[model samples]
Structures are given as structure tokens and as C-alpha cells.
Target: MITLGHAQAIIAGAIAHAQNAALKPLGIVVLDAGGQLLAFARQDGASFGRFAIAQAKAHGALAMGDDTAVLAERAKGNPVFFGSLVGVFDGGLALSPGGVLVRNGDGAIIGAVGASGDTGPNDADAVRAGIAAAGFATGAAA
Candidate 1:
């Protein structure tokens, strides 16, 4: 099992990287296998709303066992189902492209991480960098 400490370190590293790069502040979240929040952080300048968005994105990825990018693509093709999901979650679920699934060495999905407040691609890159910095694999869903 991946500890919350590890998750926090990853998120912190990601945020530090973003800050060093001069990107906008971000809110990041990590969710366990059961879609429970393990750790979260809202950078000093990040928008308050980004906290929820980041969590929702991570939850969606953890729940679906796929990257949010893939889910966004599927949602584009199945608007009705995807639309229903938003309604079901009361607008908390996001099918955006910034969440990624985290898996263990045995190929079991351990959790997921998400970032918000940057562009979708940048958010994804930050999360990827964090995961890699933690000695984890990336593009697991791809």
C-alpha cells in the first residue's frame, strides 16, 4: 500500500516544480484505491475552487481506472452517459484531462493524483513529473 506520506511528497514535489517553472499555482489531490482522499494541497495562490475540481478529477480517474484524458474522449462520444454522470455527482465529477491513475509494481492500481489551475496539458505534465519523481510509472492508462 502506498502511504499518504508518499502521496504528499509527490504532490509537494509537483507543486515545487510548477513554482520553479513559473506556472500558475495549483491545487493537487491524491485519492486511494477506494476513491478516498489521501492527501491534498492548495498552493498559496491557487483558486479556492481548484481544490474541489482537482479532487473530483482524481476521484473520477480512480473510480474508472483510466486517465481523465481517456474518459474525456469517451465522454465526447457518449454525451448522454457522461452527462448523466455529472448529474449523478451533482457536478462534482470532471471528465477533464488532468487526472492520472497510479499503480503499484504488481500492476494493481494504488491510487490516483490530479492537478488543477493550469492548462489541462500542463496539469497533466505536472502530475506526471510528480509520479516519476516518486519513482512511479506514468502513462499507465495509456
Candidate 2:
């Protein structure tokens, strides 16, 4: 059960973290465990289609129950299957490292967050910061 406040905090924290770190402008998305969009933001100067990238990252994490980093590694060994999934998911799956699953204190999954507009590791770091700021723990990278 992710509240509106939680979503806002994630977005704000992600943006602030990116800014403070001097990373490029970012686009971020948050989604409930059911893959429903909760909150999104694209920082000024972000490239076009950032929203889609962010959305795909978040949706991929939520749908597969794995962080995007794990998915990326799996995809490398299973390109054919991953390609099929891309079509099946309507291009809403990204095998990248910026997606992370959100968890409550009890370790139940609550939602996911994804960040774009920087290096993959940096994007992931920003999301981690945001989730932490929102008072949630991150699940294991798997």
C-alpha cells in the first residue's frame, strides 16, 4: 500500500539526490506492486522518451519481481527469450540497472522505482536514495 505521500517523497528524493550528486537530469517512475503507475517525473533537459524508459524500468522490476540489474544479466544469457518478452510486454521491459523493488519493514514488496537520464549505476543509486528517503528498504538485487 503505497500512499501518495510516499510516491511524492520518492520523486523528490530521487531528483534531489541526482542534483546533489551532479548527475545528469533524470526521469523517474514509481509503480505499485500491481504495475500501476503511482508517480513520475522527468527533469528538465532530459531526453525525449524518458518517461517511457522510466516506466519500462519500473514495470519490468514489478512484473518480473527482480531488480533490473538481475534482469539485465539474465537477458544476456537469454536474448531470444528476452526479445520475445519485449514484444509480449509491448516494449515495456528494459534490461537495465536502474530499477529497484521497494519493500516494507516486514520485507513485503510494496512497489518499485526506476530512474533514467544518467549512467545505469548512477540511476540506480538515485532510486535507492529516494526509496530510503521515503522510509522503505530495498529488496535484494535479485
Candidate 3:
């Protein structure tokens, strides 16, 4: 499980990382292990749909127990399987780079962070930076 404070730190850390890299404004979402939202943020200039994108990113990663980046790769080869999953999730599932699994020191899954409003890789990097800043780790399958 992820605490509110941890979620807030993740958002802050993600924004800071984006700012440092001069990336586009971002929308960030933090979700607990049960796929519930813990915290969210959208920076100025971020598009209106960023919330949906970010939420889907987190939702898909949590549901599949794999990071969105990996999911993206798998989706590329198995489009129909991933497409069915999206429907199963009521359009909540998204395969993209922004969704990264968060793990505790003991390597247990705590939650996930999803980011948008930049390049896919940048979004993923920002979330990873945020997790590290909040004293957590990033993992592929968690």
C-alpha cells in the first residue's frame, strides 16, 4: 500500500524531474496496490485529457502486474489480447511508458506512478525519478 504522503512526494518529485529536464508540463497520478487513486496533479499547459491518460497508464500497469513499457512492447505483438484487456478494464487500461510499478525496500509492490504530457520515455523516466525521490524503487513486473 502507498500512503498519501508518499503519493504527494511522488508527484512533487516527478514534477521536479520534468522541470529539471525542461520537458513539457505533465500530469501525474499515483495509485495504490488495489488500483485506487492516491494522488494526482496536472501542471500548467498540460492538455485536458492528461488525467484520463495518466489514470489509464496506472490502471493498466497495476492490473497486469507489469510496467506499461513492457505492456507496450507486448501489445505491439499481441494487439487483440491487449485490446481485450482494455475493454475488460472499461477503457482504463493503457499500454505506454509512463506507468511504472513502485516497490518498497523489500521489493514488495507498493503502488504505481503514471505520468503524461511529454515523450513516452520521458514520462517513464520522470515517474522512475519520482519513485526514487520518494524512497521507493521501480520494477517491471510487480
Q: How many steric overlaps are in each model, in order?
A: 0, 0, 0
For residues 62-107, what per-residue lDDT tens digits would candidate 2 score against the true structure?
A: 8888889889999999999988988889988888899999998888
Best lDDT among the predictions, by candidate number: 3
Which candidate should be chosen as best, given TM-score against the real structure?
3
Give the TM-score ranking, best first. 3, 2, 1
lDDT of 1 by residue, 27-137 (tens): 999888888888988889899999888988888887777888889999989999988987887766788878988877766788888999888778888887887777677
lDDT of 1 at 41: 89
Sequence-dependent TM-score of model 1: 0.91
Q: Candidate 3's error at 59, in angstroms?
A: 0.7
Pairs of residues at least 3 apart in sequence or in different chains that clash in candidate 3: none
Give a tens-digit lDDT track for model 3, residues 15-119.
Answer: 999999999999999999988899999999999899999999988888888889999999999999999998999998878899999988888888988998999
RMSD of each: 1.6, 1.5, 1.2
Q: Could you estimate the TM-score for every candidate? A: 0.91, 0.95, 0.96
> What shift in Å separates residue 112 of candidate 3 from its native position after superposition?
0.8
Total clashes, candidate 2?
Answer: 0
